[model samples]
Target chain A: MARPTIADIAERVGVSKGAVSFALNGRPGVAEATRARILQVAKEMNWRPHSAARALGGARADAVGLVIARPASTLGVEPFFAQLLSGLQAGLSRQSVAMHLMIVEDVEAETEVYRDWASAHRVDGFIIVDLKVRDPRIEVLEELGVPSVVLGGPGRHGSLSSVWADDREAMLSVADYLAALGHRRLAHVAGLPEFHHTQRRMRALRDSSRRLGLAETVSTTTDFSDAEGAAATRALLSRARRPTAIVYDSDVMALAGLGVAGEMGVRVPDELSIVAFDDSVLTRIAHPAITALSRDTFAYGRRLAEVMLALIEEPERRRDVKTATPRLVVRESTAPPGAWQGD
Target chain B: MARPTIADIAERVGVSKGAVSFALNGRPGVAEATRARILQVAKEMNWRPHSAARALGGARADAVGLVIARPASTLGVEPFFAQLLSGLQAGLSRQSVAMHLMIVEDVEAETEVYRDWASAHRVDGFIIVDLKVRDPRIEVLEELGVPSVVLGGPGRHGSLSSVWADDREAMLSVADYLAALGHRRLAHVAGLPEFHHTQRRMRALRDSSRRLGLAETVSTTTDFSDAEGAAATRALLSRARRPTAIVYDSDVMALAGLGVAGEMGVRVPDELSIVAFDDSVLTRIAHPAITALSRDTFAYGRRLAEVMLALIEEPERRRDVKTATPRLVVRESTAPPGAWQGD
Candidate 1:
């Protein structure tokens, strides 16, 4: 399908394609978001840019690289990457940069992929997704002296620029919403234990429950999906002290929890409240729309472009920028309890 | 991230990236699917045969010109493209072909994008989505000798190759399923009136209902979204003689109907029954899994690749080929109407 080209991107962003062209070519003109979406589509088209000053040269085969040692299965289910990639692509597209995707089975493979892309000049820079408790990629990328951006801040603190979202506030909002709904006992179906965000969300949720004067229990899932969400939800609902609410690390998990509630004969917002992270369209139209923290993946895309450019322009200042704020959107899935419960 | 490189593609498909490169060059492949995916992905990566030939290669822009021809707003909300494009990408990824997308606001602009791409060699071919009774694009493409594929067949028995799910068979399956469930009355939520598939499905449904000895009522929607589907569903349910079952052109529509049933105080598969098309993940996980006529979009993509190549290779024999066949996937959404309405 012939879609809106740079000309359309230019029109929407209120500029010329040449201006769009200049911004995309890593020159300047047009706001960051407009440039990002153009870049995103350009990447989607696998469009490449050459900075050799030939003006719209061609593919370098040296794409921008991303290395996260997570399971390919896990990455597929995670909304963070889904949205983040969407954002990254948006930003990269305008620049006509290509993303060469690879899924390593483990950390060793991840490092290997990173080392190879670097030595082979397969990528100009790397866009790192997750930073581990002690992520080795940072050291590897630094040692290689290849340009890159970590998706997370230097945990414990560092010189690397990171694009971080506040899951803590988002979790606290979930707890606050459930507590206000008169729920005493609550449970959170979190993501894998090792993830940086999972820990942050779990800790924030526990603190929020205590702060809100509500009782809480927590469950961790190695897999963030509807199957695990359903299983976790079932365990909570079947207990003598069943939780009045449940929060999920993913919208997919939250979606699964809906069916689990249906299976246990529990009614949403009436018998139990539900909250999900990543307010995607899937969450918005869920039978009883789950309350969620809203972060625009599309806008997340815009910001990724900004940080990438900073890394390109002022590599020293890249880490100083903050990209997004996670905010809460209350919907039909969360409400006061027992109105439809089997009490 | 280093994924399967063109070298990997050459190895897997059992050809050299040069031969894989040449076949990908659209010279000829060892077989059909092999060359198609390579060419597609080559187009996607915006890869060219000669790096030095960047001034403009011997071929076109590699875009499969798509003219929405409908209002842009209507196209965005319809998940058809989202899912369809996902399939299209899956198929094209093998060949590395990416579409140069454009949303034409007028008929002339629509025709111009094609001419510009064709004349300036901007696109290798065109992909016409949402076909009408006597699509003008077909005539235009024929005159241009441009290689193209239609998502839906034109009504006039044209000599163009098509890759469409058998909507007629799917509609009849819905009627037969309802009849076997002992439902005497049925309604269909067909898509846009001018759409060829919608017309085909509606006519088949009316005929099938009569054959099954049941009365039929059909409603049409310009928007093929869950929202409109739900609204149409609500209108039918509110009627004095509401049908016992509802069939929809898409799973999205069926999902909307599910919400409508819930809002109308109708318990699904009890007071009402539902069936849908496109057995997406949503249908599988819906509270009661939805019954549907499922077609593999993945396979559809792969085959579309084959057909497009055929059009490329033997343009004189472009009049043959159907890529997808609709099949029944029975699930929880269809059942007898209570214990009283037995078959």
Candidate 2:
């Protein structure tokens, strides 16, 4: 069967094609009763506007682009990304905007996608995540002149609007909590070093350690995978003098580190303590219920979508918003350091 | 700077507008050297084909649509979805095809989206997941005459291509494994009852119990959320004559059930056994490490993308490809029932 067009609807409703077009576009010059009749006939005939034709008439794409440059294997297991995605969808779907998503190889490929989508007008705006130190995407987005929202940053976005949580404060709170529990020897399993948030977290730990006159503090970087998280934990525990407390950058990694501790006969909260930087179902349902920095990631994503929509509607009104700081939620995982256990 | 145009590229290359067009479209009309020079000039000027114009010329959208009808909050925690999404991106990105995604309210909203996207020609094809027992979208898609691949089905998709795993056989294997482990009274915590795969799994356990002469087999349904999964488990364990072994439809639910058992002083693999229908890092890192039915979900997603691409390229070559059935991987979570543990 042939696709129903405006002409078909017009004929069925005993109206002119021009009147049907005006009714469908919700423009003036059509009577209210006639518009309703036209719409009913159109729905009955299953008529839909050709999006390309609408695009030619300067209609909005009604979609946003999210290009992630990360390993797919790691992404699947990480609740952070999934929850954020769900949240972003929740916010965008309310406004009838879809998300055009892609996973690219690296920053360079990601920039190319931005250029392509910008030129094609495939999306109304872009939502950028995983902000890095001296990020290159910011400059590219600036040059493209596209309305965008950076998911990370209190600063360093260079005029781009952003929605960020206080990562440094969150990390410092964790360090303070562990230090008060007499954990002088501290260690951190961090994510990729290039990310701004990772640097903030590492610096927070170092500053806190120096202020507290701690014996030793170390930060090891990984690719944010469970394998790397477990390996990092193994290396830390294998030392002749292992730290009494360790913090992981993500819940998946934290859980893996907990498993490593179990395998090595290190009783959590006794000889050693563990904390996760992010909280999800994984952290809550674990055997000992891992201690974690808790924040609502789904709500964060919704806030991001809200920011993007606002920016797109009024690109001239740039805003930098800071969200609530994540609070440390102590569970069954932390305690005062016991006498040093030799390897 | 204003957007670059083909005419501007033609002027720079000192070629006719027709020659520039031919070279840009990869049509054989311009000489090889001239074509290369035109391409170089076009790239230097950052020229891109306007997608709307290309669409009017009958070019492919270079995208696929995936409209999900589940709640966004539940979706974020499900590893099965996150893994499949990653895999689908891995496959589609290989060919530079983006996934246009939307989360809608229900089946009616989802079908409306299908019709809108199909009529708009905004995607090359559609990838449908979570097939229903009496799906209405299948006929809508058939009437639209759009190329599509159903991710669930051994049958029931009329005149459409499908790539499915043997859900019934996979469930049978799980039931057999539990029955052989000396578990008699079995209960299943299932996903939404309307889903075809859920029905298959529930029926498999029922048939297996009758054949194996097991006592008191039952299946309870939920909306596939950790909250509901926990509530269902709580109700089951509170019974005077609780089942010796329980199977959960997802890893998150299984983990939640483990936590509940701990809260209730039920020893896993001793007084009660647990099995999850899916597996991921959640199962692996759990203290007791849940026994689960496992499949390579990422690879399954890639396979779906491949099949959708094939169906789009040659719509006449309809195929119902069967992928490998998921296998049961026993972990520390399941064992024989020890002398009845009275509530």
Candidate lDDT values, in order: 0.67, 0.90
Using TM-score as the measure, the top candidate is: 2
Model 1 interface Cα RMSD in Å:
9.0
lDDT of 1: 0.67
Q: Which candidate is the best by lDDT?
A: 2
Give the interface RMSD of candidate 2: 1.4
lDDT of 1 by residue, B225-281 (tens): 677888889888998778788888887789889978987898888888999877766
- In model 2, state the lDDT of residue B343: 24
User: Mind giving the per-residue lDDT tens digits that candidate 2 earns over A252-328?
Assistant: 99988988998899999798899998899888877688899999999999999999999989988997989989999
- In candidate 2, which residue ranges exceed 4 Å CA deviation? A6-41, A339-343, B7-23, B26-40, B341-343
Q: What TM-score would you give candidate 2 relative to the actual structure?
A: 0.94
TM-score of each: 0.64, 0.94
Worst 10 residues of 1 chain B by lDDT: B46-55
Error of 2 at B158 (Å): 1.8
